[model samples]
Target: MEMPKEFESFAEARKNNFLNVKAAKDAGKKVVGTYCTYTPWEIIDAAGAMPISVCSVSDETVEDAEKHLPKNLCPLIKASYGFAITDKCPFIYFADMIVGETTCDGKKKMYELLGEIKNVHVMQLPHRQNDPVALSLWKGEMIKLKEKLEKDFGVVITEEAIKKSIKVKNEQRNLLKEIYSLSKLDPPPISGYEMHKIFDATNFVVDVEAKNNELREMISGLQEVAATGNSPVSKDSKRILITGCPSGGVAEKVVKTVEEVGGVVVCFENCSGIKEKCVNVDETKDVYDALAEKYLSIPCSVMSPNTGRMELLDELIEEYKVDGVIDITLQACHTYAVESFSVKKVCNENKVGFMNLETNYSSSDVGQVRTRLEAFIEML
Candidate 1:
């Protein structure tokens, strides 16, 4: 398939992400590696440090990680550990410090092992997001993170810096939301895989200004395509909404299989998808408190009461006019695996087609996944 002209720049940016990080490091800038969206990029930017997400989805590294990690753990954790220990990922190697969050037990335990290899600061994320004490504790954790960054980097993170960073990040979020809105159209200008790639590429780009400009250009290009009624997917294609655990490299396989079987993924409510871009930090309030509230607002499975995620999913299903919903959970990701029941229940109540797909990083299950996806598409 030919690449879209507007997305070309972003594709180039993704291709050179490692080089960009290396250049920034060589120029005397501190780079912080993170795994989850809950890690506030605004805070890292304010501290004069470049924050890059370090999640890996390649099956190639799983064997190396399996030597230490359990065989049945989440592939994401294993791949991440594999990349770190094998020195295969440049971003992980370039990071001056890693910010770990207690988003899941697998990650929390994996960090203990990771810390022995690299300098890691773990953030104690609260499970009860609705309680006042939980919010206060999270706020304190953000403050503690800020202090640690300042002490380690020898840079003062001023209020002005934080506000500026929030403004830039908010702009990015707005642009992403606009891009997601296009999926609601009768025939989206871009494919789901294309949209996922655009969002995924942003993880490595440290230059927010440049990324924002690229986003604006891509939006303009999409607008032109929409005006011409030119779409990458057929109008009769069955629209799908994928929700569950984050699928990094496997995202391409899942999306490709759906498309190949005559279904189009109109939206995603996963970690690396639209959910992360839906909320923005309020610059009007105290930046610290605002950051805490914004990050904590993310409906991660770790939260005790995660009904917010279901609410958000329902909204997207209606907004996108989805015909079916696919919940993709990496094998042994217990939290999301258990949460799949709630997603299925909600889908059944709404009379929307639902499929719970459980798989791992290896390509050995590609045929099985494809067959199941093909059957699901036929039902829709």
Candidate 2:
């Protein structure tokens, strides 16, 4: 099966993300490292800084991270802290400032210790999604972040700058949504692993116009391939919807296992997927208010009574015609682990198969996870 040149381009882009960020730093560009999807990227952009995701997905640094952190904490937190302390990841190393949110206790506490090593700024996130007061509090936090960025970087963030950032960010989101939607075609033109790689690489691409143009070309190329009846997957393959914690860390074991068996992951409801791309910020409203409302609506497990997640899951399952749902929760990530019950209930109501698999960043459980996935895909 012939693939598009853009696919290779995306892979190569990620392969050199570290160097890309390093180049930006060398050019005297301010870099802002972020950990979660909750961070307001527009504000960071408005502050005249490059916002890059600093979350770590590999277990290579976990052992070192556990020295100062708890052994049982989320691998993401430990690996992230480990990278910071060891100066392993160039993104974290080149970051002029780090913006964190109170999305989870593990990350919040880790930020405190991380502050000792880096210039860390924490945002007070309110979990209650529907309350007006909570929105106000979140908006205030956004303003505080703006002021902090201005003070630290010696650049004032103006209303015009944020409005432009919002437009540019939405353009990227729309492009991603279009790319992700291509999976809705029977016998998807691309593999889940390939699709995920593109999403993960978007965070590190420095030139927004060039990145978006590449995505547009990729979309056209994929559609042309699909039109010719060339697909990377079989129509009979089980269409799976992934919903849970940030999956980039565990994708090697889980995503690869699914495709290796007989399932095709059609949708991702996590941070690495449509969770943040499905909605766009309203350009008609106040910049701060629009940003607060748009970001606060993200359906992460951190929000109390996270009804939005279930609703989004239900919608995706139908839209993608998913045959099953896999909820991958990282060990010690209690929020997603507990929320798995509700995710299962939603799948049950939709008459779709559901499985909850919990594991860490280590490859020690590779065989065990493979065995379970084999049985699950066989049952599907």
Candidate 3:
């Protein structure tokens, strides 16, 4: 399928994040690598440090990681560790420090191992997000993190800098949200894969203003396509909502399979999806507290009483007019695997078709996955 010219720059950026990091480093910019979206990029930006997400979804690094990590561990964690140990990832190599979060047990323990090779700072994310004490603890952690960045980078993170970062980041999020809202149109002007590419590309790019402009242009192009009655998906395509683990690499595979089987992925409620960009920081509040509140609200499976995730899923289902839900849990990702049961229950309560797919990073089961998705689409 032909892509809009406006989106070409974003697509190119996704392929060259490493190169961009190299250029930034050569220019003497300190780069901080992060593993989770919960890591406050605003703080990193304010500290004059480039914050780049270092999560790995490639199967190529898993073999090396298994030498240190258990073979049965989550592939995302294994792949991340493997990339660090093998020096296979440019982003990891360029990073002066890696920010780890307690999002899941596998990741929490894996960071310990990652620390041996990299300067790792682990954030103790609260498991119960709504508890007042948990919020206070998280707020404290954010403050500590801010101080650490200032001391480590030798740059004072003033409130003014943080607020500016917040405004820039919020603008990016709003643009992304606008692009995602286009999916609500009948015969969505863009495919889910295209939307995923846009999101993934934005993550790699450091220039928020440029990215925001590119996104606006892309949205305009999409709107023009919609006005002309052009759609990448057929009007009869089954609308699908995907929720579960991050599914970084697996997202493209699942989306491709679904589309090939006559389904259109209209919404994604995972870490790598629209939900991550849907929330904006309250600029009126204390920057640290606002960051704490915004990140805490993320519906990661690690949090107890994950009602926020369910509520978000329910809202997306109704808003997108979803016909089915596909819960994707990476093998050995126990948090999401266990949460799939509740996700399935929610889908049933809504009278929507649901399927739970458990897999790993390897493409060996592509045929099996495709067949399963085909059957699921048939049922829908």
Candidate 4:
């Protein structure tokens, strides 16, 4: 049950991460607040600014957010906007610039409102991934973003810097992928809870080298333990695959319910999981084309006819030997909410149990969710 000592630091890093961002800001470092994974971190890094996800995963500020946003909006959007309006999140508060993408109608509109208060720039994200026009538009947006960062930070984002950043970010992705792949083993070496903590804290741990090193060490330790048949998880536990909206706000409710009821989540098909980290940018290609190709390829439900998600789900389900697929859709996230049907179809085709739960960042439905998850896993 023992893990690498670095596991403990991830928790500590999450707690004091804001201070790190504050310190960076105080030291005259430019901080860019990113909402979606589609934002190119390499470009921001190349521009001499630190890119941090400002996505709020709590309902503490949802009420404040609802004051301006509709009461029925997605909690992720509400909480994010709430943090911005209330200046509750240090990442958003210290952000020199907030980079948003038109990933969804809610977020796109939210960015418009957010711009009224903060320095916000919205990228016109193309939803059609395979369309040539979409890639061109995305590439153009990447250049615009690069230009915006340069203009704001007074630094040129040279091609050389971007290439270097692409390598660095790719390295981080590969490390994370290796860590997550550890779950592919029977009786995964790490618990789903522990794995979630490591994955969630990735953005908070800004020191890429330290983060990568910690992951490498964790991987080594985990492989050793797994090889010795000393896994923290039970071999007979139901292997679950979570696919849906970002799970950060709802992980405590969902992941806990699964593990507490004799299930182990081996794959996360959502952004909080492997959705963004699974693919690496092609270093040989032009920086803009590579960024466009890699990001646009992400299988978020925002894309029209998101067949990629189904393919990814199929792959992960087979790879992890999933017993059930839990599609967690946030309230009013119409894209994922509606896309759940297709996800269920995919699960059925793969002969896996499928359960779609539409909820929000509120604990009010925790009991109900747990009851349903218990029934679902029991059925599985």
List the global CA lDDT of all models.
0.88, 0.90, 0.86, 0.89
Per-candidate TM-score against the hidden true structure: 0.96, 0.96, 0.95, 0.96
Candidate 4 overall lDDT versus native: 0.89
Cα lDDT of model 4 by residue, 244-317, tens digit: 99899988999977999989999888998899998899999999999999999999999998999999998899
**Model 1: CA > 4 A from native:** 1-15
* Error of model 4, residue 184, in angstroms: 0.8
Off by over 4 Å in 3: 1-15
The sequence of per-residue lDDT tens digits that candidate 2 reaches over residues 1-380 is 22223224234545478667877878889999998888999999888799999858888789989899999999999999998887767778788899999999999999999999999999999999999999999999999999999999999899999999999889999999999999999988999989999999888868876899999999999999799989989888999999898899999899989999999999989999999998899999999899899989998998998999999999999999999999999999999999999999999999999999999999999999999998999999
Give per-residue CA lDDT, model 1, range 190-243, as digits (tens): 888888888888888879999999999999999999999988789989999999
Provide the RMSD of all predictions against the true structure, rounded to 1 decimal: 4.7, 5.0, 4.8, 4.8
Instruction: Tell me how candidate 2 scores on lDDT.
Output: 0.90
Stretches of candidate 2 exceeding 4 Å from the true structure? 1-15
Q: Given candidate 2, what's the lDDT at residue 203?
A: 81
